[model samples]
Target chain A: MKKRCWRILAVVFWLLLWQTAAMAVNQRILLVSPLETLQALFSLLQTAAFYQSVAGSLLRILAGFFAGLVLGVGLAALAKIYMPLREMLFPVMSAVKATPVASFVILALIWIPSKNLSIFMAFLMVLPLIYSNFLEGLNRADAQLLEMAKVFRMSAFNRIRGIYWPAAFPYLLTAMRLSLGMCWKAGIAAEVIAQPKNSIGSALHRAKVFFSTPELFAWTLAIILLSVTLEKCMLHLVNRLGRGLENAR
Target chain B: MRVERLCKAFEGKPVLTDCSFSFPTGETTAVLGPSGRGKTTLVKLMLGLLRPDAGTIDPEGAKTFAAVFQEDRLMEHLSARKNLRLAVSTPDQQISEALTALGLPARDETPVSQYSGGMRRRVAIARAVLADADVLILDEPFKGLDPAAREVAANFILSHCPRAVRILVTHDGAEKSLMQVKNVLDLGMAKEA
Candidate 1:
């Protein structure tokens, strides 16, 4: 409770500072007050177009995230088992990590429709992080425990559930927390560039073009809120799944 | 089970050389030696966790093996019962009885991570005993137990694995008497029992 109060106070202080700055500037195009931003957000909330944009972006980005998660886990497991595959993926994952998001956005636009750009961008941003972290976790599993499993002749499924899952869960969680934020930022950036119809990025681009500073701030705030909420929900589900695996017979 | 001219080395240092032994079924064979005398290396070779530099271990007809390692290798995130469940699908009632007999809390939901060292050791012992393997290898299984708990664990192991080819590796001489072990393979001199 005390921490929450401090957080609220800190936010209010920043808002007051922003309001004072806007008043001193005396130019609506240059800066907007916190009140104006909130008002714009409220107005946006009342429109059906706002809902469609949010829903469309949310579905596409989440589809990309889930697809990346499955492929990342699968690829990591295969890499762990097969040395040639690990060697083959080393340069690919490194290239994905090193390349700038904007460069990928530009290159991808030529090959795919603008409607699918955000999904592709989000998936690309997420895959390498999940793969590397989960593989590291698998590498760190207790060797003694694995030997015990072998001597006991445990089935492959039981060995994975009992040994591998527990070791890899924390790494998987870390990857999810990081990639969730990255995917959102990159996905929205793609949307803005690609100008997908009925997307939050398109709305943000329109707000920018019209010099509607308040609307731009409101959309940015909405994206932050949505990203944080999605991250929290995903982490909760993963933690529950980890607990179930630990206690399973 | 018999080992024929077994030899093992680590980085050109011989740990065991030309060692041979036949472990009888339905009896306890204690592999007694001091520290750094290849007691663990011998067991690991038998469990197929390590490859011998030479010779072979024939299981005869023993199909399955279980072990209590030097460290308590129980899943730290699982309860004692759940750890046993990973090895065998024994019913809950029997699992609880085995845990209770070993002086662990049978119904407790606490993960083994929160257990005491002695409690964790007992959990490891219980896992091996309940694994129902034809060959049971115990490497210092009673390391962390109190005298009373050690006695209980010994009795539980003896009672549970009557027909197994029991191979015990330990430094404590008292465990031999407690488990009523008759066949002794003293590795310090590399001599046959």
Candidate 2:
């Protein structure tokens, strides 16, 4: 409780500082007060446009996140089962890791429509993290437990559920915690470049063009709020799933 | 199971060389050895977890196996009963009963991560004893137990272990009688006074 109070106080302190600096500047185009930002946010929430933009962006980002998760886990499994496939993927994996997100966004824009760019970018950001960590976690399987499982003549499915899941779950959780935030950031960035009609990124672009600093702050706040909320939900699910599986075994 | 001319070495050091033994049905065979005498290597070879440098282990029509490795290999994330329950075809009540017989918590709510060394060893014991298998291999299964507790564990093994051949790797001479072992293979004969 004390920690939560401290966090709230810290947020209030920063907002006060921002408000003071905005008043000092006295230029609406240059700065926006916290009060003005909040007012802008409230007014934006009253519009159908706000909900349409939020829903569209939320759907696009979530689609990308889920797609990345499935492909990441599936590819990790395939790579583990087939070493030749892993070898084939090495160069591409390295390229994805080394290349900047902006480069991929721009490059992808040429190959696919702007509406599809967020999916590609989010998948790009998440794939290597899940792939490498999962492989590492799989490698870290407890030898003693594995030997015990073998002696018991456990079937392959049981072996995975009982032995491997406990070993590999932390990696999965880590990948998710990292990638969910990444997918949103990359997804929004993709939208800014692509200018999809009903998107937070397109709204942000318009706010920039109009010099509506308060509107820009409101949208930025919305992005942060959504990111944190999604993170909490995802991590809660990960922890519960991990404990449930461990207890089930 | 028949182990013939079984040889294994790590790097260049010879652990076991040309060791031959046939485990008989309806009996317990104790392989008595001190540390560094290839006892564990032998157990691993028998369990087919490691490839022997040379030789063979013929199952002799025995289809299934259960074992307690030197390390208490219970899943640390699971409760003691859950670990035992995962390994066998027995009902959950029977699993708890087996744990109870060995003086372990029947419905332990705590994960095995919090278990004492002796408690973990006992859980491993319960898992092996409760498994429905043709053969049992126990490597230093009584390592952390006191003499009194050792007798409880030994008795449980005798009563519950299948009549088919069971192999026990231990250093305790008293265990030979305590477990009512029918045959003893002293791997440390080279060092035994």
TM-score of chain B of each: 0.96, 0.93
Per-residue lDDT tens digits for candidate 2, residues A1-249, read: 999999999999998899899999988888989889889999999999999998988888888888878887888878878999989988888888899888999899999999878877887888888787787777678888888888897777667767788888888889889988988999999999998889999999999999888899999999999899999998998799777766664
Candidate 2 runs further than 4 Å off: A1-9, A247-249, B190-193
**What's the true lDDT of residue B145 in model 2?**
89
lDDT of 1 by residue, A1-249 (tens): 999999999999998999999999978888988888889999999999999999999988988898888999999999999999999999999999899999999999999999999999999988999999999999988998899899888788788887888899899999999998999999999999998999999999999999998899999989989999999999999999888776665
Q: How accurate locally is residue A55 in candidate 2, as Cα lDDT from 0 to 100?
A: 90
For B51-79, candidate 2 gives per-residue lDDT tens digits of 99999999999888888888888778788
Model 1: docking quality category: high
lDDT of each: 0.91, 0.85
